[model samples]
Each structure stands twice: as C-alpha cells, then as structure tokens.
Target chain A: MKQRFLKAAAIILWLLIWQILAMIINKELLLPSPYITIKTLISKMSESSFYIALLYSLFRIIIGFLIAVVFAFILGVISGLSKNAEILLSPLITVIRSTPVMSFIILAIIWFSYNLAPLAVNIIMCFPPIYDNVVKGITNTDRKLLDMAKVYDIRPLKIFKGIYLGSVKPFLAAGMNTALGLAFRVAVAAEVLANPKYGIGTKLLQAKYNLETAEVFAWTFMILLLSYLFEYIFKIIIESRRYNAQTRKSDKVI
Target chain B: MLRLENLTKSYNDNYIFKDFSMVIEKNRITCLLGKSGSGKTTLLNVLSSITDEFKVKYSDFEKLRYSYIFQEPRLLEWYTVYKNLQFVLDNTHMSKQAIHEKIMDSLKMVEMEKYADYYPYQLSGGMAQRVSIARAFVKDFDVLLMDEPFKGLDPTQKEDITDRFLKMWRENRKTVIYVTHDLDEALYMAYDIHVLGEHPTKILYTSRNAYKMNDTERENERDKIWQILRSQI
Candidate 1:
C-alpha cells in the first residue's frame, strides 16, 4: 500500500511540475497546460475516431509483432542448433540490428502500401532482439542436463520440450518485452510518416499540423497510455507463464 | 561384462586419460575412487558416450541402454519429479498407464512418491538428488553411470540416500559405474573399488570383494584402501 501511494505521489509531483512550467510559459500554442491536455483527452474519449484510430493502429502493430515473434523463434532455433546456420544468418541479423529504423521506414513506404508500412517497419525493428535472445538462451542451456538427456537416450523432441524450452522461455519472454516496446515506438513513427487513413499516428500528425498543442499532448498522452497498458498486459502474461511453468507438473509443449 | 578397452581421452591438448582399460563386471556395483581432477568423471563421460573425443571399445555397446545420475540432479526445472521420470521414459514402448506405474514405483524406491507433484525448484538438494536417482532407475537401462550424485548431501542424508540406492540396485542389478572422490562413499557403495591417481591419470589400485564381508572385515578393507589411496597422494 505504501509503495502504491508513493508511486501515485511521484506521478502527481511530475504532473504538478509540468503544470507549473506551462503556467510560467503562458503560451497555450507552444506548451499546453496539463489541465488543457486532460480536458482534451476526456473530450476525445467520446469521439468515435479516437477508438477507430487506436483499434486500427493497435491491430497492425500487434499483428506485426506476433509475426516477427514467429519468424524470430524459428530462425533462432535453427541458428542455435547448427553452426552453419548461425554463420549464414549472422550477417543478416547484424544488418537488421545496426540499420536505423527510419531507413527501414522509408524502404517500407517504397515497397508497401500506407496501411502496411508501419507493420513492416515494426517487424523489421522487432526481429533482432527476439532472435538474439532466443539464440543466447538456447546456447546457454546447461550442458550437464543435456548430457543427462543424451545418456538417458531422450528423444530429440522430448529434449527440445523438456530441456530446451525450459532454458529458452525466460530469455524469449525478456526479449519480447523489449521488442514489444520498440515495436510500438517504431510502428507509431512509421504511421506518422506513412500518414495512414486510420491510426493514432495520423491523428497525432493532424493535431500537430493544425498547431493544436493541447490535442497533440492529449494524443501523445494516449499513445503513452496505450504503450504502457500493452506492456503491462504483456508483463502479466509473461509473469503468469513463468508462474505456471514453475508450478505445473507436466512437460511444457514448446 | 562391460569391457572398456584401451580408452583414450584428451581435451585441449591435455591428456586426462590415456590407454586406460578396465573390465567392468556386469550387474555389479563398481566405484571409481580418485582425488579431484583424476579423470574419474572424464572416464564416466567416455563410458556414457557424452565425450566424443575418446576411443572406448565396449564389449556389447550395441545392446546397452545407458542412464546417468550426474553430480547435480540436472532435473528439468520446468518438470515435476514425476515428469522428470516420464521424460526419460518417453521413447519406451510402455503405455501411459504402465509408464505412470513405473514412475510411481521408482519414486517409491527413492522414498519420494509424495513429492511427485513438486517441481525441481521446490525440492531440497537431497530430495532433488533422490528424484534424479528415481529418474535413473525408472528408465530401462543395462548400465547406470553416476558422477558423485551424492556429493552435496549431509552425512545422514548421504546414508539415507545410499541405503535407498543400494536397495534399488539390489532389485535391478545393472552394471553400475559410480565415480566419487570420497573414500567412505566408495567403501559404502561398491563391491569393487578402483582407485585412480592423477599425474597422467592411471588406475593405482583395484579392490574386489566378490563375497559379502562382515562389518569388521569391511572396516579392515577400508583401512587397506585408505592406505593405498594415501600412498598415491
């Protein structure tokens, strides 16, 4: 309870600082006060476009993230198992890790329609971390346990389920958490550039272009809210999985 | 009989075992006693085919099923005690009910049937090792290789686990190769004890008690084995 109170207190303190700073600036056009942002946010809650924009953007980013997860996990398992695969995949993984998200956004815009540009950028941005973490997790599996498995003549699929997944799940969960956050950020930025017909990024761009600073702040607040909410939900899922894994009696199906 | 002829193993240009040969009696408990770094575990690994850089010609390698009880439990943390047993038994032709019954029997052997639902993390060290022992026994194998599986147990816990191990071994008399550095453990566990020394990794002494000895005789044998081990040190 004390910790909860302290967290709320800290957030209110920051909001108060923002309000004071806005009052001193006395320019609603440049830096909207917290009160104006909150008011605009409340009013926008009733707007049908707000839900449409959030839902569409949320679907695209989440679908892109899910697809990237599938691809990364498959590639990670292959790379982790075979030295030749790792050698072949290293250059591409390195390129994806090093290249800027903006460069991918531009390339995505050139290759895909406006609706797909953000999703493509999200997948590209999210793959490397998940893949790297999965490979690392599999690589770091306990050799002794593996030896035990071999001596017992455990089938390959059983070893993959009982041993490999036990080692990889935590790393995969951690990587997905980081990848999810990055995917959201890059997805929104891509949407702003692509100017899609229905998205939070589109609404954000419109508010900025019209110099509605309060609406921009409200939209920014909405984005932050959505990002935090999604991450929290993802965290709960990971934590519950970890908890279930710890408590369950049977082998987890990988 | 399981004969490991002219076994040679080296790692990173360091020869841990060179030209080592031993005829391990079938369906008998054989303990490899040595100090730390005396290639005891390396020899076990070679026997189990876990180390690939060794040449060990076995007498009946094709007809053997090998199970290992590692120094650590090595139980899958995600699996409960019963499931760890189930994992090794997956390739067997047993029906699900038969496998479950076998798992329960093994757990009962190790006195861990009550912990069937407990995951590895929930187990105490000795309890986890007992689960590992159960896992080894639950599998259908002709030989069981152990690498100091009882290394970290307290004396009482060690005695309890050793008693259970012996009881289980009595029921299923597979060729057992147990590796350990502890003298008392060697004396307690093996009918045949082979003492190894380092400086080139060779067998220094081999004591075989083909017949069951009384406690006094065993004590005298322990003293003799102690003297042999001391001379090597």
Candidate 2:
C-alpha cells in the first residue's frame, strides 16, 4: 500500500508538471492541459470505434504472446534435453535475438495485414528471451537431482512435473514477465508503423499530427494500464505454484 | 547373490582397482575399509551403478535395484526432510499408507522425527546426512550402499547413526555395504571388512568377525586398521 501511494504521488507530480508547462505554452492546439486530456479520453471511451480497436489490438497482441510462450517452452525443452537439438536450433535463436523488431514489423507488413504486422513483431519479440532462459534453467539443473530421479526410474509424467518443472519454474516465470513487457511495447510500436485502423496506435499517430500532447499522454497512460493489468494477472497465476506445491494434512492437494 | 567378479575400474588410465573381486553374502553387512585414495568410494559407486565406467565379468544380473547414501547428504534443498521421504515414496509400488508408515519408522530410527517438517537447507551438515540415511532406509531397496556416510560427524552422532543404520539393516535385511576411512566404523558395523591398498588398488587384508560390540577397548583394532590405511596412503 505504501508503494502504491508513492507511485500515485509520482504520477501526480508528473501530471502537474505537464499541466503547468501547457499553461506556459498557452496554446490548446500545441498542448491540452490534464483536464482536457481526461475529457478527451472519457469522450473517446464512449465511442464504439474505440472499444472495437481495443478488442482487435488486444486479441492480436495477446494471441501472439501466448503462441510465443508455447513455442519457446517446447523448443526450450527439446534443446535442454538433447545436445544435437541445441546445436541445430541455437543459430536460429541467435538470429531472432539479434534482429530488430522494426525490421520484422516492416517485413511482416509486406507479407501480412496491419493486424498481423504487429502480431508477428510481438511473436518475434517474446520468443528469444523466453527460450534462452528456460533452456539454460533446465540444462543447469543439479546433476545429483537428475541421478536421484533416474535411480527411482520414475514415470515420465512424474519426471516432468516433479523434476523438470520444479527446476525451471523461476526461469520460465521470469522470462514470461520480461517478455510480457517487451511484447506490449513492440506490439504498439509495430501498430504505429503499420497504421492499424481504430487501434491506440492510430489515435497516437493522429495526436502527433494534430499536436495534441495531452491526448497522446492519455493514450500512453491507457497502454501502460493495460500492459500492467496483463502482467499483474500473469504474475498471480505463476506465483500460485508455490501454493500448489503445498499439500494439506487432510490429504487435499493445494 | 551380490558379486563383483574381476571388476576393472579406472580414471584417465589410472586404475582405481584392477581384477578386484568381492562377494557380499545376502542379508549381512559388508564393510569396505580403506584410506581416502584406496578406491573405497569408487568400488561402492561401481556396485551401485553410479559409476558406469567400470567393467565387471560374470555378474550378468546387473538389474538389481539399489539405494545409495553418498558422502554428501545430497538431499533436495527445496523440500522439508519429511517431504523428501514422502516424495521418493510417491511413485513406489507401495501404498500411500505403507509409505507414511515407512517415513514414520525411518524418522524414529535417526531420532529425527521432530525435524520431519524442516527443509534440508535448514539442517546442519550432520542432520542433513542423517536425513539422507533415513531416505535410504525407507526406500525398500534390495541393497543399501553408504559411502563415508558419517563424514563430518562427531563421535556421538556417528554412534547414533551407526546404531540406527544397523537397526534398519536388521529390520529390512537388505544387503548393506558401507564404505568409510574411519577404522572403527568398519570394526563397529561389519560382519566382514575388505581392506584395500594403493596404486592399482587391491585387497591388502580381510578380517571376518573383526570386532565385537560392548568391547569398548577399541584402541588395538583401530590402530591395526589405521596402520593398513596409512601404509596405502
């Protein structure tokens, strides 16, 4: 709660600064004040086009992120398990990591629609970090633990759940958290480039041309809120593992 | 039925043991006594199949399951001491109730019933090793292999652990093969001690029914075993 209060205080200070600066400039066309930005944002929120844009943009970017998660996890496990697979796929992962998101977004625009350009960029952005961390995590698991598991000759399912999953949880979750933030940033950047219709990027681009600085700030805040909301929900889900690992005395699984 | 016939094991062309052979009689404690470099740990590893580099002749039955207590406790750090036992028992053919019973029994043996819920990270070096001992005792394997299982322990802890281990061996009657540099440990625990010596390690001596319990004048026995180990070093 104290941390929340501090964050709120910081945002208030920044907004007040923006408002005072806009008053000094004294031109609504150049920079609307905070109240005007809020009014514009509230007015925009009531429009059906705004909701439609939000849904389409959210669906595409989120779908891209989820696909990347699955993609990284599967390949990461394969590379972790075998030397040959690591050698084969490592160059491709290196290439993905080094390539710029803008380059991919532009290439995707030529190959796909506006919706897909951002989606593809999001996918590319999310995969490399996740794959690298998970593979490293699983591979670096203690050899002694692996030996203990082998001596037991446990079932494959149990090996996955008990041994591999336990070893890779922190890495996997951390990668996802990092990738989540990058995904949203890249997704919007790609959107602005592709000029996706009815999206926040479209509004942002319009604000820039019209010189509505406060409206741009409002849209930026909205993007921040949405990204934070997504990350918060995901963090809760991942942290629940510590809870699930616990078993009750009543023989109930947590 | 436990036999290692003409087993040859080496590391980087340095032979740990060559043409070494031993037969462990069923349901008895066989102690391997040696200096630190005399290949006691290596031989134990070979028997437990933890060392795959060794070649053994005339031991066609390598399918026998084994439980090992290493020199290090090697307990999983994330789990409580009791949960470690519970988890190892999770996929066993034994019923849940049987596993719970075994955990309780093993915990009692080492006087670690109070630390059932403490994670391995929280245990001292000695306590962690005791939990490792308890884990092996509860596993219900055909054989138990302990390698310097009492390393870093003081005298009282060693005695308590050795007693608990012997009691476990009695209850389960699994073929127990324990390795240690401690001279009295072999004297205290073994029905037979196979003393190995250096440089292409081989059995220097063998003593059967070496020392009796309650004969606390262990000086002579300790010095004799110590001499053989020192000569190898």
Q: Candidates' interface RMSDs, in order?
A: 7.0, 7.4
Model 2 alpha-carbon miss at residue A206, Å: 3.3
Compose the digit string of candidate 2's lDDT tens values, residues A37-123.
888889879989778878877876789899999999999998998889999998998888888777888999999998678888889
Tens digit per residue, CA lDDT, model 1, A1-254: 99999999999999999999999999999899999999999999999999999998999889989999999999998898887999999999999989988899889999999999999999988999999999998999999889888888888998898899899999999889999888778888999999899998899899989999999899889888888998999988877776455455544321
What CAPRI grade goes to candidate 2?
acceptable
Chain A of model 2, TM-score against the native? 0.88
Instruction: Find the candidate with the highest lDDT and give its number.
Output: 1
Chain B, per-candidate TM-score: 0.93, 0.88
All candidates: DockQ: 0.55, 0.24
* Alpha-carbon lDDT of model 1: 0.86
Candidate no. 2 TM-score: 0.86
Tell me the RMSD of model 1 versus the true structure: 3.1
Single out the weakest 10-residue window by summed lDDT for candidate 2 chain B.
B211-220
Candidate 2 ranges with C-alpha deviation above 4 Å: A1-39, A243-254, B78-83, B90-119, B122-127, B153-158, B211-218
